[model samples]
Target: MNYDRILAARTSRIKASAIRELLKLAANPDLISLGGGLPSPESFPLDLVMELTEKVINKYGSAALQYDTTEGFTPLRKALVEYINAKGIDAGLENIYITSGSQGFLDAIGKLLITPGDYVAVEGPTYLAALQAFNAYEVHYAQMQVDKEGVIPESMEEIIQSYPVKFVYTVPTFQNPSGKTIGVQRREKIAEIILKHDVLLIEDDPYSALRYKGEELPTIKSMAPDNVIYASTFSKIFAPGLRIGFFVAPEKLGRWLVLIKQGVDLNTCTFTQALATEYLTGGYVSKQVQKNINLYRPKLETMLKELEDNFPKDFKWCEPDGGMFLWVEGPEGMDMEKVYKRAIEKGVGFVPGTFFFPNPGDGIETMRLNFTNIAEEQIKQAIKILASVVEEEMKITSIN
Candidate 1:
């Protein structure tokens, strides 16, 4: 029964994600969860999906269900070319490859790039799944600085100067965990640095279209096309269960990823790709995106209002212009682990922010709250309960 000796050494680097672990608790119907960054079911275009499904089966037939080429379905790639161009990223079908999801591409990148002890420069509080994906490759990390504007170019440039990191991985637009977007001006500087250093930049943009507020910023890929690999997904916009996503890399790297994917899942789901093609070319993405924005915006506004009225004066948080989640920093010396226990006991739940960082000890006084899925009334109640727990934790910490 003992398997430790039989397991690969790389397995040691992997650990359970805190957000994923928190998801198990959030499944309890009795609890009000501000945990998972889930899209609202209200926003799902179910009628459209059913319509698309029929068209795909009738038109594509067995091709929709069969194992597709590693390069992905041609129609889907063609549609994405137009989609990315619309997003201001000029890329051809040759530059794109589909995967199971953005997470699949992350794993492929790790496989293609990382070696034992190789460094990947990442934001201090980057996407947990990326950290988890890279961990499997036994890669070490050089933490980059993240201010209110998200990953700082100056900090990333500084890291590149000293650390021999293989590449810079980022979630620049409506970044996960922090939900902070790097400004347009900063993105240009970041692109400049990447070109000068000639290092690979993985620009993840799953939440870019989820903008509920603020003006859109140019993608880092648009600025430095040849140097950056852009990762995006349909999970946020459409449905996560569909498991459709892609990455656009330079021609050479793009080829490499296709070969890499050949060994992974062969290709992303062709049926799903067919659906996504219809979703894009059929002009459903924009309409559905607007629906998502309308559905989520009020929850965000309500949560912010509740926090302002209920949270302690010194407890800090950011009002993100868009995205499913926001960051909250509690009073100094408060351990969010204990606070999570209290929150759950009060029939509420949230992700303790410590797991977002490369180091466990950092972000101890912080937590990430998701406003996308919860109802307005439940969000109000959840925030009230969470705020009380935070207040009580700080009081206990202060007293001791």
Candidate 2:
């Protein structure tokens, strides 16, 4: 019963995510949760999924249901190669390694490259799951500052110069939590710094295809191909449940990643991979992306307008061109955790920003709001309720 004594010490490094735990409360009808970065069920290409499933059954038969290589289904890998190459990255099936999801690729990188106390650099308010994945390996994280254009290149260079980092992790395009896209100049600057220092970079880019505005900026992977390990997923554009993700690394690292992957899950689901291959190759992917943009853009605009109209003048938030979240910062002395509790009591829930920071206390005055999961009407209502909660919380904090 007392398993703690027998458990590995590495387990101590892991902590349950506050947002994930809060998300469990979402099933309560009273909760209008924005805590989880989940896509709208409405956005999933359900009709296309049914069609693809039938196609897979017709084409692959029982092989679609069978065990597969750790490197993923070859057809999926080949499709991803063509996809990436089209994106202007010189990748091929040989350079691509598929995992259960992009999250798996994160874990694999953590497993392969991170030793206990290894230094990893991340954006100040980065993806909580990534921090969690790397933490299990007992890696020490250093935070780089971020601005309107995502991670500040000067801060990144400073961190790399000051520390012997194993790799610099970035969600450069439409980054999670922040929703700030790294601009072209910043991307170029980052590429130059990484090459000059010969540091490895892990570019987690699950949101690039979701762009609804602005010109597409080149991926950091394309800029410094040799030093970058690029990971992407169909989860954002297609369906999350399929859990299909791929990575492009140099041949040496790609081989090792596949080997590590084999020990973990043997391979991703064969049927799912086959389905995704069809989805991508069948010309459905682009139409689905456009559909997502059509549905989400107006909702995001609604939230932004509501925030502008309702929130206190001092409260700051980003205007992301695309992505699922908007990062908001309350007044300097305000406690976002307390505010989150108040918001939940008012039937609105959002992720407190502190959870995104590797150093917990640093982002206490911030929170992340997701606009994609809810409808336009619900978004307006939720923001109104949230504004009321913020007003009440600020009044209380002011009195205190």
Candidate 3:
């Protein structure tokens, strides 16, 4: 009955997510958690979803409940084609495919392309879930340097030059963990670099629609359509429970991903896709996104103000244009993990940033905080508690 011997060798590389475990601690009702990147429950259009449910069942009838193609629900794919085209990426029905969520594409891409020991060039402090997905495929990461503007194009090019990377991955706009968005010029440079090297890049953009301020920037995929695979999800603007995500890729890669997905889940949930199709064609996205912006913008501003007024000057954080999270970095050799532990004891929670780095012992001075899930007053209270914990930790570090 020893399952270790019967399990696949790949199981060794797939460890439980540290953040997932941390979230459990944050689940206590008294804890004010900034640990999760969860969209606000307030952001979900609950009434509209119920309304759409009736419309979908009435419109599609038994088709809504039936099995669908491995590629995806066709109407959803067609709606997404227009959705992305508005972003300036030139794509069509053939180029569109759906998955259970963006997480599904992450795993599918890793399975479709990576061989054991193959290299993947990723931003130094990248999306932690991506590392989780690729780990199962036994892929090694070649870390890229990042600045306030997100991944440096030169750093990505250097890694690509030095390694036989299967593909390059990026979350260019309002990136998770860091809340850094690459500027348009950098996006152009990244596009040029990918084209120059003839490399494939994955542009995972789930936050662009959540813009609270500033003009919308062009996607890297728009700049290099042939070279980048663009993935997005309804989790932010819509409901996460639906678990609906989709991607646009070059025809050959798209077909291969579809083939790979067939063995995983025959198809994504048809009922949810039908609801999303109506959500799109019904023109609910713009209104829902605007409502989210109105709700989150003030929380973001409140957190920034609280940080400025309460935290030590040496402790700096990213001023993101739009995103659910903020990245805070303390002075050198200052461990945020210690601060995280202390903050939790005080009924406030945030994620230590080191786990986001593919390399161990990096980003020890950093942490990520989520603003969208908590209220403005709670944000004020949580930051005050967190700032106090950080100050105490700094004093201890200084004494040591």
Query: Cα RMSD to native, each candidate?
Result: 1.4, 1.4, 1.2
Model 3: CA > 4 A from native:
17-24
The models' CA-based lDDT, in order, is 0.89, 0.90, 0.92
lDDT of 1 by residue, 175-251 (tens): 88988889988999999999999999999999988888778889999999999999999998899999999988899
lDDT of 2 by residue, 175-239 (tens): 99899898888899999999999999999999989898988778889999999999999999899
Alpha-carbon runs more than 4 Å astray in model 2: 17-27
- Error at 152, model 1, angstroms: 1.8
Candidate 1: residue 6 lDDT (0-100): 87
> What TM-score quantifies how close candidate 2 is to the native fold?
0.97
Poorest lDDT segment (10 consecutive residues) of candidate 2: 18-27
Model 3 RMSD, rounded to 1 decimal: 1.2
For each predicted model, how many residue pairs clash, with residues at least 3 apart or on different chains? 0, 0, 0
lDDT of 1: 0.89
Judging by lDDT against the true structure, name the best candidate: 3
Query: In candidate 1, residue 60 scores what lDDT?
Result: 93
How many Å off is the CA of 355 in candidate 3? 0.6
